[model samples]
Target: MNSFNEEISSKLGLIRNTLSETGASAVRLRGTDWFAWATAGASNAVLLAAETGVAEVVVTAQAAWILTDEIEAERLQDEELPGTEDSANPLYKLYINLWADSAARESFIRDVTAGGKILSDRPTGDEAPLPSSLVKQKRVLIPCELERYRQVGRLASEAMTEVLSNAQPTWTEYQLAGASAQALWSRGLHPALTLVAGERRLPLYRHATPKEEPLGRAAMLVFCARGYGLYANLTRFVFFGSSQANAEIRNYASGHRHIREIEAEALNFCLPDKPLNGVYDVLDRAYHQHGYPQAIRQHHQGGTTGYLSREIIVNPSSSQTLAENMAIAWNPSLPGAKIEDTFIILKDGRLENLTFDPKWPSVKVEGRDRPVPLEID
Candidate 1:
């Protein structure tokens, strides 16, 4: 079998194992993240605002099926579902019903499972919810997923370079945000979240939404871009004034350097099998040592990332442990300074930054190249 087919078969095996463990006849996936992971990057999301997708996949020990309305069935079969028309072992069987016929869809599901117990990711009626352990299974990405994730990271970083490199002091926060969105969209990426904070607003809000305030001397651009069902998160800063002349700009740069040191400490602590709480302890200590004792309490330091923007949020008491082949996005933030990047813990136990762009100016922090604020004066 080809690699792609092998990937699908392996995922199916995982679902079947869950079925046996839970004593359920079938497993139903209704969330967009689960759909993308199961189908090797096929998206079921039509309404971006909805947590659940329009179609669902049902997997049994014997076979798998896709249940959707007629409006989506044809397109999904022709474009999304894996395997060819004449393949000896197709991955999924398509089952369609009228858009308004809820009873017909229910009857089909019931007949397919022969009235056995059904476990769903987002359970509605009678069906039990899938366990959190099953959801955490997605943390370790397969080979195909790793390739797609690298591509997404490269695209997202390039978009940041393209937009932020040319940023001017006269541009409003909203304009910067619009340009950032355009850059991502033009590269076939969806801007899941975009935030811009000008100099006047940066010190006030940690989660700064874009506004009409013009960037006086500096600004921060943040993006959570999605492609192929994976998210690539990053943050960049631009300064339009001279650091030597402006005391505030100098102070901002110093804070950035301090935060970079804290980030370096956190990254170095992300060893395989290490408890996440250990990393949190390191962060708390580093912040205190850097003279920002309240920084940890002000904002959440990021954690594991994959199908969701954040698979887990690391805290002082988190029970999750760092694992090999898991993707992580740590955003260590302070009042006026923050840094973020997406990274993967390779099977060899080395951390690789997926979103590194060679063209972007960076500084060495503990032997690793870390992004720094861009001075455009």
Candidate 2:
């Protein structure tokens, strides 16, 4: 079998194993993230804002199927499900109904499962919710998925570099956001989230949404770029003034260095088989050691990321453990200063940064090159 087919077959094996473990006969996935992951990058999302998608995927031990309304079935079959037109060997059997016929859709789902116990990612009615452990099986990406993730990460970083390198001191936050969105779209990536904070707003909001405020002397550009069902997150900063001349700019730079130190510590703690909360404790202590004891509480340190922007958000109370082959995106933030990058824990337990751009200004921290603010002077 081709690599793509092998990838799908491996995922199906995982689903079947989950069914055997959970005592369920079939599994239904309705979340947009789940749909993309199970289908090896086919998108089911029509409304980008919604968590659930227009189509659903059902996997039984014997076969798999895609169920959607007639409005979407044709396009999905023709475009998304490649090699599915062959009658002798199809990736997934299509089960479609008219968009307006809710009753018919429900009846079809019932008949397909033959009244067996059903498990769903987003449960409704008598279906049981899929276990979190089963859901997390998507975290360990196969070879093909990792290659696509690398491509997405490279495109995302290139977009960030292009947009921020041309930024001006007079541009408004909205303008910056627009340029960022355009950059990602031009590279065939969707800007799942774009946050631009100008100098005046940077210190005021942690999750700063773009606004009309003009960038006075400094700004932060953050992007969560999505492509092929994977997310690559990165944050870059720009300063227009001389750090030595302005005390505020100097302080911002100083805080950025401290945050970088915290981030470096967090990255170093990401080892296979380590408790995720152990890394959280490392961040908490790193912040305290750097004289910002309260910074850890100001924002959530990011966690595993793949199909979703964040598959898990790490906290002091988190129970999950870091594992090999899992992708991680950790964002350690203080007001006005935050650092984030997507990384993967390789099979050998080494952390590889997926969003590294050699052209971006960086400083060596703990023997690793970490991003620093780009000064335009």
Candidate 3:
């Protein structure tokens, strides 16, 4: 069986238990990330933007059905549907999932359950609080998903590194962001968020989107690139001219050191089974311990990242527990400095930094390798 199919089947099998317990005969998924997991990477276009005419239906005791419009019907059948060599072939069925409300749902009930009584968990339906039992399972990465994350992370880092390394003092914030986006698109990666901050805008704004401000002495480039329905969240800095141009550069350097120390404290606290609030507590304490107790509050400290830039953010009162195989992107920032990178937790409870690129210059603080401020002459 193809590994993708295996992943889908395995997920469906687990979902069946949730179905049984809730007395739900089937679950319909419309969210992009949920759809991607259900199809085992067949529906990655949902990552770039939302589109109509596609849905995934998984029954308690049956295989998954990939419903699409007539436009994609021929292509999917010809290319995506399994052939004779596939062992999990019987576990998947393709049908058009979109139609006018009543008729569409009726057809789905008939095709999906073969006339069985059903309770559907529609995310947009009257369901309150949005049922998560069926989709939360995706928080844990499987082997096939990890492979895609690795490749996408590498591509994203390469693109960001290329754009920031060649930065110039005359480049406007908009120009830098545009170049970063172009670089990512050239390699099939889509920018979910492209933020740029030049020397004039330093540290004042946390989410400094691209502006026309010229990159005078230094700048920061932040990007959340998506590929294969997975995301890589990263941040880098570039300094123009000499490092001693002014006191601002030196302060930025000092801020970088302080934030890295805070990041290390937070990351080292990210042990498996640790509560997210505890991690936040570590961040809060680190900021205070490092003389910037209020730095973390200036901007949101990032949390788990995977299909979305942040699956969920970590807040002071968050209760979510960290788990092995969970992808995380922690961003701890001060006024003029910030550190963010995508990483995944291994089965042994070790965090693997996915956004690290040897081609980019980095510094070692407290024995931990951190991306150094790029100096461009």
Top candidate on TM-score is 2
* Steric clashes per prediction: 0, 0, 1
- Each model's lDDT comes to 0.87, 0.88, 0.77
Model 1: per-residue lDDT, tens digit, 9-106? 78888999999998899999998888888878778888765667878889998889888998988888787775522267677777889998978989
Q: Which portions of model 3 show Cα errors greater than 4 Å? A: 44-60, 75-90, 97-107, 110-122, 127-134
TM-score of 2: 0.97
Error of 3 at 216 (Å): 1.6
Predict model 1's lDDT versus the native: 0.87
RMSD values, in order shown: 1.6, 1.3, 3.0
Q: State which candidate has the highest lDDT.
A: 2
The digit string of per-residue lDDT tens for model 3 on 58-176 reads 44465566666656666666654543124545666766634344477556656656554454434443332224654466788888899999998999999988998777899999999
Which 10 residues in a row give candidate 2 its minimum summed lDDT?
A: 82-91
| Candidate 1 residue runs with Cα over 4 Å from true position | 82-87
In model 2, the clashing pairs are none
Best-to-worst ranking by lDDT: 2, 1, 3
Considering only N, C-alpha and C atoms within 3 Å, which residue pairs clash in candidate 1?
A: none
Comparing 1 with 2 on TM-score, the higher-scoring candidate is: 2
